[model samples]
Target: MGINLQKGQRISLKKEAPKLEQLMCGLGWDVAKKKGGFLSGLFTTDFDLDASVLCLNQDGKIKSNSEIVFFGNLRHYSDAINHMGDNLTGAGDGDDEQILVKLPLIPQNIHKLVFVVNIYNALERSQDFSQVENAFVRLVNLSNNQEIARYTLSGNGYQGKTGMIMAEIARVGDDWEMMAKGEGFQVKSLGDVMKLYS
Candidate 1:
C-alpha cells in the first residue's frame, strides 16, 4: 500500500523502498459521462490524452528534444525512461498509460523527471480536464509491484485547462523524491508544454 499524496506533498523513495531501482508511474482517468438525453452515449467521442516526461538536467532545464519521453518518442536516449504507449480513449479500469523509470540507469546530469498529460487537439476537440474524472498518478516499485505513492487531481480546479503537470521525481542527494504537482495549464499541445521549460 501507498500513501495518497495531496497536492504539493512529497515523499522520499529511498526511505519507503530502500532497494528501489525501477519504478512504474501509472496515470489513469475517465471521461465524465454526459448527463443528457437518451442519445448522449451514442454521440460521445473518445478523449485522447497523452502522457509525457521531460528529462531535466542539473539546472532543471531541458537541453534537447531527445530528453523527452512520449508516445511518439517511446524511450529516452539514456534508456532511463520509457513510455509504454498512448491511451486513446482513457476507457479502462486501471492505468490508461504507463511510464517506466530505471533510477540506476538515469544519468547523473539528469536531475528530474516531470510527468505531464495534455489533451491531443484539445482546442479542436473542445475538451479540457474539467470533463475528466478520477485523474491520478501513482508510483509503484517495479521490483515488488508495490505502490509507493499516489496523487489524485481534482477535476474542478482544471476547468478550461488542457494540460496538467501531474508529478515529478527528482534526485535528492543519494535518493529520489516524488512530488505531487497537479498544476493545470491552458496549452494546446506538447510543443506548448515544452516551451514552458525551454
Candidate 2:
C-alpha cells in the first residue's frame, strides 16, 4: 500500500519503495455527462483530454523539445521515458493515460518529470477542467503493481483554466520524490507547456 496524497503534499518514493526502479504514472478522469430531457443525449459527449510529460534537468529545465513526451511524440529520445498512448475520451474506469519511466535508465542530467493534462483545443471549444470529474494522477511501482502515491484532482478550482500541472517526480541523487501540484494554467496544448518548462 501507498499514501493517498493531498494537494501540495509530497512523499519520498525511495523511502516508500526502496527497491523501486521502473515507475508508471497513470492519469484518469471522467467526461461529465449532463442530464436533461430527451435531448440530453445530444449534448452529452466525450471531451478529449490529453496527458503530457515534460522532462527537466537538475535545474528543472528542458534542454530541447525532444524532452517532451506526448501523444504526438510518445517517447523520449534517450528511451528513458515513454507515453503509453493518448486516451481521448476518458472512457476507461482505471487509468486513461499512462507514462512509464525507467528511473534507473534516466540520464544523470535529467532530474525532474512534470506531468500535465490539457483539453484538446480547449480554447476553441471553450472547454476546461470544470467538465472533467474525478480527475486523478497516480504513481505506481511497476515491479509489484503497488501504488506509491495518488493525487485526486478536483474541478472546482479549475474554473477558467484549460490545463493542469498534475504532479512532479524529482530526482534526489539516487532516490526519487513525488509532489502533488494540481495547479491549473491557461495553456491549451502540450506545445504551450513546453514553452514554460523548456
Candidate 3:
C-alpha cells in the first residue's frame, strides 16, 4: 500500500524510494447512484471524466501541444509518458484511468508534469465533483506493482468544482518530487483548464 498524501505535501520519490524509477499514476472516482426522492429508485450516471497530463518546461510554461497527453493524445512523442486510455463511465474498482511514466526518461526540458481530471461537457451535464465520492489519485511502482502514494480528492473542498488538479511531479536537479495539489477549478472541461498552464 501507499501513504495517502495530504494537500500540499511533497514526496520525493527518487530520494524516498530509490528503486522506484518508473511509475504508473492511477486516477479513480465514483459517481453516486442517484436516488429519486419520491420513487427512491437508484439510477446510474454516466460521467466521462478525462485524466490529462500537461508537461511544462523549465520556465513552467507549456512548450508545445505535443507535451500534453489525454484521451485525444494517448502518449507523448518522446514516449516518456503514456496515458492508458479514457474511462468513460468512471466505473472501476481501482484505477479508472492510468498514466505510466518513466521518470528517468522525461526530457530535461520538461521540468514539471500536472495531472488534471475534468468532466466532459461539465456545464451541460450539470456535473461537478460534488456528485463524486471516493475520488483518489495514486502512484504505483510499475516494476514492482507496489503503491508509493495515494491522495484523496473528495469532500467539501471539491464540491461544485468541475476540475481537479490532483498532483504535480516536479524535477529539481536530478530528483523528482510529487506534490499533492488537491485543488479544484471551475472550468467546463479539460481544454479550458489547459489554458491555465499553456
Candidate 1 deviates by what RMSD? 0.9
Model 1 TM-score on a 0 to 1 scale:
0.97
lDDT of 1 by residue, 87-152 (tens): 999997999999999999999999999999999998898999999999999999998999999999
Q: What is the lDDT of residue 90 in candidate 3?
A: 88
Q: How high is each candidate's TM-score?
A: 0.97, 0.94, 0.94
Task: Give stretches of model 3 more than 4 Å off.
Answer: 35-44
In candidate 2, stretches whose alpha carbon ends up further than 4 angstroms from where it belongs are: none
Task: Check candidate 3 and list the clashing pairs.
Answer: none
Q: What is the C-alpha lDDT of each candidate?
A: 0.94, 0.87, 0.87
For model 2, residues 91-185, the per-residue Cα lDDT tens digits are: 97999999998988887888898999999989888788887889999988999999988899864878778889999988877788899999998
Candidate 1 runs further than 4 Å off = none
Report the poorest 10 consecutive residues by lDDT, candidate 3.
Answer: 36-45
Q: What is the C-alpha local distance difference test score of candidate 1?
A: 0.94
Per-model root-mean-square deviation over C-alphas: 0.9, 1.4, 1.6
Better of 1 and 2 by TM-score: 1
What lDDT would candidate 3 get against the real structure? 0.87
